[model samples]
Target: MQAQRKMRIAHYGRKPVKIYGKTTQIDSSLMANTTQEEKRCSFITLNSDPLYVAYHDEEWGVLVHDDKMLFELLVLTSAKVGMDWTSILRKRHDFRAAFARFDTKIVANFTERQIASVATNCNLDLKKV
Candidate 1:
């Protein structure tokens, strides 16, 4: 006799979705019904992970020359070691709050106590850049 496929349940917002197969928990919002190339460039193949898609489509290789933006990117990139970029993207708001919104001069002149406080609060291993 043949074995029947098992089903799983997952929630999308408040609606319960019946899922099957190894990966069937789909988010309809992210599915635009576009071709693979239309979704992103050839370099990005992490279509299953939304953060990677967002990074590739929205922020990857974009020219950033502003001091504040540059500082923010620097801080985020510093925290990217050992942790995934998805986590970094998720914690971006918290990082800005903790790091004085990445104001270059403010961050540059940060007291050791303040730096220590932010590090402890955010639990981020930041590189000195």
Candidate 2:
């Protein structure tokens, strides 16, 4: 059996339209015009900070099923306790560098000396797991 095709919306200009039948269907007259207010009110607001807002909008709330990503978030969130997220966010690069990039197999093998070294650093507030 063949899978059924789903109808999709296409944008001729600014408006979302669905082409149906022999005649091209214009979904609405509103597509030709858009106001700044309308744009701002869109589901995903584009008017945001390039760095912080982009990460928040794209990756912040998105679900993660990958083990590496899960471990990274875990380490980051744990390291962030009693501290501001901004500080943790800023030091994320350093954390990756120091922690071997959250490789589960590698971090799982960390010795007490390794954990102690990372915890003593001014940049990281590592906790012994």
Candidate 3:
């Protein structure tokens, strides 16, 4: 019988982590003193506002299958064209109130007068509405 050769597995010293869509090596020592929340969040979210960090952790890449939620995401993304995400997140409540809770049927039937009224009441840009 022929003898079988043993296969060896190579081990890398450092751990490779994906940060902001890029893969990079992270030193375990760097996270020694961080809290559980900080350790679990991305690098960009380390020093960000709590609300922004919460969004990153809870909803940034999570899938949405609900119609109302999908509509809300679409509206928020469109509103972010010239604005920052933090601003949009902060005004989420206002958008919901102004857009009829993102009910597709309700928003689809909005008249110019209703749009103008919503814009004025919510202090939103008229053109954006």
Candidate 4:
């Protein structure tokens, strides 16, 4: 779908708005009256962070049918016990290696020694897993 035009609450000239007890000019020419859906589609989110915006635009709320992808998501989610999503995304490669590339069978068959190795070498929080 085509992205809607971006809009901001800008004001100027004769129109003064009370913002935080300060009088600010409101620019009516740039004002936009958009539907909720249009606003949502225009930007990934209200967040201004580029990485967060990219993540929301590209992967947020998307379906996963592939086993590998779902497994990756599972590991990522599990690892977010005390960490944030940006940290988890940055550590994706470490997670994949720690979890045997997220192969369901391989991960399931991890030996005690392998588990220990992962705990020692990776930043993963096994307590959460």
Candidate 5:
């Protein structure tokens, strides 16, 4: 049997879709008959994963400038050693909260106490890195 296929947009509020098979564009007439509920459900599913879909659509694999931001991404990527990127992405806010907005200077100065605190916070998983 063929594997079940599903597609999702990388970002919320948008419907950039990808198909697993060769079906390119369905007929407009056919789509016209698709229920609004179905369309909405499909869109929601695309953006409903554990991570922020908008970030994938907007940032993943895209070239980033800004040395500070680049450094931040690098740190997070390294922190993701054995974990999924989506998990890290979902906890981005928690990281920012703990690390003081990814300010290199601030993070660099983090005390041992701060490090210990973050290690226990369930919102983020930083032990691997």
Candidate 6:
């Protein structure tokens, strides 16, 4: 005798979706029918913070061709070691201003006093600075 498998239905704003065992099977047509607001990536959907959502949609995974912008991304990624991306992005403006908009030459010229000032103003970790 074979055991009968139970199926479940889940609602997702537009329609009732069928769930079978451990997997969910969605129709290709259903995906096409979903609105833009309903078609976001899982991470963005999970967080839903406006700034984070915008970053995911606009910046995350996009290639950077500008030298200064690449430097900015490198600095921000380094700063994210012990922190969450949300907090890092929240302070992005402060970081930009403090780091001379991530201009490589200008930042290389920052003196000890300037570094300390930027660190204090941006509340950045000294070791990371």
**Which of 3 and 4 is the better model by TM-score?**
3
- Cα deviation at 61, candidate 3, in Å, is 0.7
Report the C-alpha lDDT of model 3 over 39-120, residue by residue, as the tens digit.
2433555468778767765676554569999999988887787788888899999999999999999999999999888778
Worst 10 residues of 5 by lDDT: 1-10
Clashing pairs in 5: 10-53, 11-53, 11-54
TM-scores, all models, native as reference:
0.61, 0.57, 0.62, 0.60, 0.53, 0.66
lDDT of each: 0.65, 0.59, 0.68, 0.66, 0.58, 0.70
Query: Which residues of candidate 2, in runs, are more than 4 Å off?
Result: 1-50, 122-129
TM-score of structure candidate 3: 0.62
Worst 10 residues of 4 by lDDT: 4-13
Which stretches of model 6 miss by more than 4 angstroms? 1-39
lDDT tens readout by residue for model 5, 1-129: 111111222122233244576444423443333443333333346446635455544566444568778877977787677777778887777767777777888878988888888667734456566
Candidate 4 Cα deviation (angstroms), residue 93 = 1.5
How well does candidate 1 score on lDDT at residue 80?
83
The candidate with the higher lDDT, 5 or 6, is 6
Sort by lDDT, best first: what order?
6, 3, 4, 1, 2, 5
Ranking of models by TM-score? 6, 3, 1, 4, 2, 5
CA deviation > 4 Å runs, candidate 3: 1-43, 121-129
Cα deviation at 44, candidate 1, in Å, is 3.9
What is candidate 4's CA lDDT for residue 33? 65
lDDT of 6 by residue, 1-129 (tens): 011110111122233334455554544443444454554555567547899888876677554679999999988887787888989999999999999999999999999999889878877787864
Position 104, candidate 1: lDDT: 73
Task: Give residue 89's lDDT in candidate 4 (0 to 100).
Answer: 78
The backbone clash count of each candidate, in order, is 0, 0, 0, 6, 3, 0
**TM-score: model 1 vs. ground truth:** 0.61
Lowest lDDT sum, 10 consecutive residues, model 2, at: 1-10
